[model samples]
Target: MLRIADKTFNSRLLLGSGKFASPQLMQQAVAASNCQLVTLALKRLELDKPQDDLLSPLKAMNVQLLPNTSGAKTAKEAVFAAELAREALQTHWLKLEIHPDARYLMPDPIETLLAAEQLVKRGFVVLPYCSADPVLCKRLEQVGCAAVMPLGAAIGSNQGLQTRAMLEIIIEQATVPVIIDAGLGAPSHAAAAMELGAAAVLVNTAIASSDNPVAMAHAFALAVEAGHSAFTAGLAHHNNQAIASSPFTDFLAAL
Candidate 1:
């Protein structure tokens, strides 16, 4: 089970509800992924409206709605967005992301750490999306973040495990859950992250942009399970030289 704060989740795959062609497709993908937690961008929500069409279906599915500060450029902005999302969604679970640069969407680690400290003090379940720096991740955890989300690569880059070395270190040292987020374009990438002992992974663009999102979501779910199982089963040690699995014998020569 993946434990974040006091809540425990059976599924390790988290989904971002964006980039889908329609709300229906996104819903389908969510159902197919079997994710207990789904992230919704605060910028995409219409808080002033009586009811949101997009939110009703997701609520019906009974999954935890994780509101995010996607467009916040600073710590102050992220706090305001977090308050608004909490009010709108009626949930305190937040995915704190402060990316000042639009081109690469690289998460601002300083701003993220700042905001996480404030949010946790304000009685919110904070999960900050941050860079793949072990020191930064430790700082975020020290500030009481429920989990530290380190990137596998740039946001939506489809590059797999570009920061594998850093991620391994983060996972090794983290007391809190380390969720691999962003730039995971394929199921194999997700599996690799799980094999490295990530508590979970958050995916959006990969599944949303796929030709068959529902099927793709299912595939990712399977891959996460497979990877986690492999980790639990204990993988073989890395070796520079080859070792024979079968005994070499001269019995064939005698025959």
Candidate 2:
């Protein structure tokens, strides 16, 4: 189980409720993926509506809600968005993401850290989305973030772990969970992340955008399990020299 801020989740695969063809399909995908945590951007939710069409179905799914501050460019704005999500969604858990740049959709380390600090102070279970910087991850963990979400690549780009080296460092040093978020194009990518010892991953565009969302979600779930199993089984390390399974002398003796 992955523990984060008083919650224990059995599934390491977290799903994002965005870019899906329909809310029903998203629900089906979530069901198929068997993800315990699902991310929904606060900016996308209709807070004013009592029964938001998109949110109602998600609520029925009974999975843990992870409301994100996606559009907030500053710490203050992010905090406000988090509060609104808490009130509307009835959950204090938040995925803190502050990206001022529209082109790359790169998370602002300064703003993210600041927002995480504030949210933690306010009794919110904060999971901050940040760059794959070892030092920055430590800083967020120090500020009481439940988990550090480092991008595999640019958000929604489906690039797949461009910052693999940095992610390894973050996972090695992080006291809290390290969740690989963004830029995972396929189940293989998610599996690769798990194989690298990531505690969890948040996937959105890949499964949602696939032609068969439910089937794709199942593939991702299986991949995550397989990767975790491989990690736990202790994969062999790389080496330049290869040793023969049976020595020549041993074979001759058998003969």
Candidate 3:
């Protein structure tokens, strides 16, 4: 079971509710993925509306709604967004992301850390989407974030684990869950992230943009299980030279 804060989830796959062709398709993808947690951008939500089209199905599925500060460019703006989300969703769980760079959408470590500290104090279960920097991840953990979501690559880039070395360090050092987020484009990528000992992975573009999103979501779910199972089963050691699986005894040599 994947445990974060006070919540324990059966599935380690986390889905982002964005970029789908329709709300129905998104729902299908979510159901196929079997993710217990789904992230919804605060900017996309209609907080004033009684029944939001986007939120209703997810609520019906009984999945945890994780409100995110996706468009916020500063710490103050993120805190404000977090407050709105808490009131709107009636949940203190939040995914704090502050990216000032329009082109790359690289998360600002400073702003993320600042926002995490403030939100934690306000009793929100903060999960900051941050750069693949070990020091920054450690600092975010120190600030009482429920989990650290370090990027594998740029947001929606589908580059896949560009910061593998840094991610390894972050996973090795993290006291809280280390969720690999962003730029994972395939089931294999998700599997690789899980094999690296990540607590979970947050995927958006890869599944949503796929030709068969529902099938792709299922593929990713299987990959996550396989990878985690492999990790738990323990992988074989890497060797420079090949070693024979069976010994070549003198009796076999006589033949």
Candidate 4:
């Protein structure tokens, strides 16, 4: 069981329900992924005629909602949006994303830090998405974040862990769960990141943008489990050359 603040999760693979063909397909993918937590965007909510049908299927599947501040521009906007998400999604667990830059959707660390500080004080389980920088990660962790989501690369780049070195540093120094988010194009990338000891991974584009999202979700589920198992088993150390098991390296013992 992986614990994030007061919440304990069974699955380490967290799925996002965006960029899907249909809500049905999204539901199918979520089921296939075996993902207990699903990141949902808040811009689609209609207050008066709240169509809970979309949320119904996911709720039926017993998944926790992690409402995200996807399009907020400033820290104040993000804080207000988080309050709205709490009302609409009926949960205080928020995935904060304040990307002032639109081209890549890269998070603004300044805005994120401010938002996280406020959210945590207001009784929210805040998880901020930021660049894979160790200092920024520590700053967020110091403010009582449930977890830190550092990008592997640009969002939807499918470059597959371009920021691996920085990510490794973030993981090493993080006090909270370090979920490698974004730029994970394939299950193999997720597996590789998991092998490096990331607590979890938040995947969306790779699954939602796939030819067959449901099937791809299952594939990722298997890969994450395999990688986590390998980590638990303690993978063999790397060596440039195979060393002889016998005492051949010792000159005194050599005949």
- Listed in order, each prediction's TM-score against the native is 0.96, 0.93, 0.95, 0.92
TM-score of 3: 0.95
Error of 3 at 35 (Å): 0.4
Where does model 3 exceed 4 Å of error? 44-52, 250-255
| Backbone clash tally (model 1) | 0
- Compared with the true structure, what per-residue lDDT tens digits does model 2 show for residues 1-255? 889889898999999989888778999999999998999875554678665377776678778999999889999999999999999789999999999999999999999999999999999999999999999999999989999999999998999999999999999999999999999999999999999999999999999989998999999999999888888898888889987777557556666
Pairwise TM-score winner, candidates 3 and 4: 3
The CA lDDT at 73 in model 3 is 96
In order of listing, the candidates' clash counts read 0, 0, 0, 0
Candidate 2 Cα outliers beyond 4 Å, as residue runs: 44-52, 246-255
| Global lDDT of model 4 | 0.91
Candidate 1 Cα deviation (angstroms), residue 189: 0.3
The lDDT for every candidate, in the order shown, is 0.95, 0.92, 0.95, 0.91
**Cα error, candidate 2, residue 250 (Å):** 7.7
Candidate 4 TM-score to native? 0.92
Model 1 TM-score? 0.96
Error of 1 at 146 (Å): 0.5
Task: Give the clashing residue pairs of candidate 4, or none.
Answer: none
lDDT of 4 by residue, 21-62 (tens): 989999999999999999998775467884647888989999
Model 4 steric clash total: 0
Least well predicted 10-residue stretch by lDDT in candidate 3: 43-52
What is the Å distance of residue 221 in model 4 from its true position?
0.5
